[model samples]
Target: MELTPRLAGMVALLAFLPVVAFGVFRTWWAGAITLVNVVIIAVSLYLLMSPTESEAHAAHGDDVESAGDEAL
Candidate 1:
């Protein structure tokens, strides 16, 4: 089955929730470390998957330098 972004997110949440929950219940330090690790992983994944600013402009046929200069 193809893993769409939404599905992937759900899968990741499911996979982490149990371990994090267990850690949290066991001790403060474990909970903090696990939570921080999860946040870092999620952010890294997001940055890697998202398109760069130039790529987004190119995809929409917009001039990269002029993207923010349009009149409101």
Candidate 2:
């Protein structure tokens, strides 16, 4: 199965839920930090998985077809 951005984020969030739960049992601040970490990780995964503008265009066969267009 391919790991898309949404899937990766879901996996990361699930993996971190336990840490947040256990952290909450210890202290509120610990739980808060873990929650923040989860958000950051999810966002990072999405950004990393998604293609950039040029990459997206290239993948869709939207790139200039002619070699001469490369210089522009």
Q: Per-residue alpha-carbon lDDT of model 2 for 1-72, expressed as tens digits?
A: 998988888887886768767686788888778778888988999899977887865666655674346556
Name the TM-score of candidate 1. 0.57
Candidate number of the best lDDT: 2
lDDT of each: 0.66, 0.78
> Alpha-carbon error at 44 in model 1, in Å?
0.9
Which ranges in model 2 have alpha carbons more than 4 Å from their true place? Answer: 60-69
